[model samples]
Target: MVLIFLFSGIQAYAVDPEVPDSEEAISAGQSIFNANCKTCHRLDQKLIGPALRGVTDRRELAWIKQFITNSQVLVQGGDADAVALFKEFNNTVMPAHDFLSDGDLTNLLSYIEFGDKVDPAAAAAAAGAEGGEAASSGGGIPNEYLTIILVVLVIVLVLVLVVLGLIVSVLTKYMNKNDDLDEDDKAFINQKTDYKGIFKSDGMIIIVTAIVLAFVVKTAINGLYTVGVQQGYAPSQPIAYSHELHAGQYEIPCQYCHTGVEIGKSANIPSANICMNCHMHIQNVEGKDGISPEIAKIYDAVDNNKPIEWVRVHNLPDLAYFNHSQHVVVGGVECQTCHGPVEEMEVVSQYSALTMGWCIDCHRNTEIDTQGNEYYDKLVQLHSESSNDALKVKDIGGLECAKCHY
Candidate 1:
């Protein structure tokens, strides 16, 4: 009887047609999740929302569907589960996903269920092995080693030229001694070989003057170009913060610190409270002394109700009106597009020139991503109707002077 029951349970779990099984569905679900849900939900850990792993196992399929479709309606309807969940999350309302089809919801649920079943250690090991293989395959000679090789080659070439010059000089002197050339011819050869006198000639002076003037003009042009640009401007901050450690090693998201990136004009500097979120537990640095002095600075500020005076790295002119949300939330620009490889930076610096020309060039080149954004649907349709070519940002009002300056 126990064997019969076990067999029945296995059949029920395995034969569910609603459950997503294909790679295509899972990939689509992942894309959908990254576009819509990643700002709040994580698979194994909590962010703004609860950890989503095993969510399908915890809730009924019907209940999960309804909740995802319209949580506000469920809450207002006084559904016990919905109300309880809302209260548990400090009344943070889960946005309704009514636009998601039944298939999409099923796929998303399947991904969550599959994620819960995956062993973390095994996944990590697989990732590490893949990374090792990629590094081994793609790693070329280091730039420093290449530079050393080039220097050695140049020195060898210089030595060969010197030896050739000496040989030619010896041959000329031997020919002169043998009386193979006339006296006037010998004197002419001697005068031609006088490099010091040649350098002091009017022709050489003219060439030198032209070269110097060209260099001066080039330098002046470069100086003018860099007048207001602050690319690579790395300033020391009040506190020691390693973005490489936090963002790269620890895998923390950029949006976690710069909370305003998706909603406001600025990707605001994280407050001391935000620092305490992690540093409260992680007070000490690994492979170092007891408590990290750098982390202690955050604690001190929190204790004294003071804000850490973090130095601003990227800045824009007052005349330009750049909105963070417009680019990040609407345009869906990656943080790395403007910030460069910040995860690799020990100390963050201004990566882009942030000049008017830079902005114009980007606007001209960038294509509008109108996949899920309803706001661009009409604009995209209009553009397609007007032109057979792919719609770029410049096709819209992105290049208008008033859009940025005014």
Candidate 2:
């Protein structure tokens, strides 16, 4: 019966694309999860947080939103469910999520509801519904809007310029005609012809002002856009490595490849010795006998009988600094969080935008892991004073420039 209702709900939403239960809410909820919840919570399994499966059945939407928006508060308020869950999890408060708006919270609730009652046919139909729309579009500023705006702006600018030029020409001719007058008269005429003064008084003044304003805005936007992009950076390697296979299918733990992340300053590229540990035994792969061609690259660098060439990914610029220890060890950020799902990738790619905006967004929204990290003991103390017990990432200073830049 529950499954039947779920299927009916999906079909009902589908027949009415403008309806609330349609994919928009589901996709928005998915985005919210990807951005905020996936790190600690899984839908079906016990991770850092309780499995979210069947959450809708167990909790009301209002309670779920409040819990997600501020779990610590519910725990402190002695809400039996929140308090019991908190204690069950060792009194570790789930991080507060004050950033999600009411609409976003609703979307998440809808998704949770859908997940609980999902039917396979409905799921398939939902997936197939948007295929045509996605494939036909390119990802960038939409050309249609860009073209329309640019054309309108150009036309307005040209009209303004033409009017200004006409006025200037008239003034210039009048001034020249008065050239034969007395010197004082000529000086008066020249003053009347002053193009700069005319520009200040005419409609041209507004046009020039608008142009300057537009230029300033464009420059400021571009400056902000480049703040955290590392387009072509390549760094020296501890060992030569090939991403082709490891990422391709051997599907080694990203933590395995970048092991140092669990304990040190970087998701440090594995040292040559680490490579030897694996290469020494599983020297061959993909049915190619002997040290696979890629593994041989590692052996070459180690100066062992065989060698390997490892290239660095996620290289921070010289001006910027990164600490794997701080993020991985202290913040409890997963290695794959910033580096991306490297195990499933063919070649490593810079997955996170690593932009200041991107970093700050995560920092602002992510709940800090406060339970065991002594660094957050003081913050946890203050939060306890409030009836609400949520601990925000900001409360722990995740957005401080020194946290990343220094």
Choose the strongest candidate by TM-score.
1
lDDT of 2 by residue, 203-311 (tens): 8878898999999999898677555435333333333344656655566666765777767776665566777787657766657543344554554445433333344
> Candidate 1, which segments miss by more than 4 Å at Cα?
1-229
Residue-wise C-alpha lDDT for candidate 1, range 1-406, written one tens digit per residue: 9568545533544334576656677677788777667656778766556788667667778888998898899899999988998997768677889999998898887666553344457899777665444433124553444567889999999999999999988877877787677888888666556789889999999999998999899889867755744778776677789999999999999999999999999989989998888876785777753355577577657655778877567777788999999899888899999999999999998898888889899989898888887888898899989898777888888889999996
Worst lDDT window (10 residues) for model 2?
11-20
Candidate with the greatest lDDT versus the true structure: 1
Error of 1 at 116 (Å): 58
Off by over 4 Å in 2: 1-244, 247-251, 289-291, 304-309, 372-377, 384-389
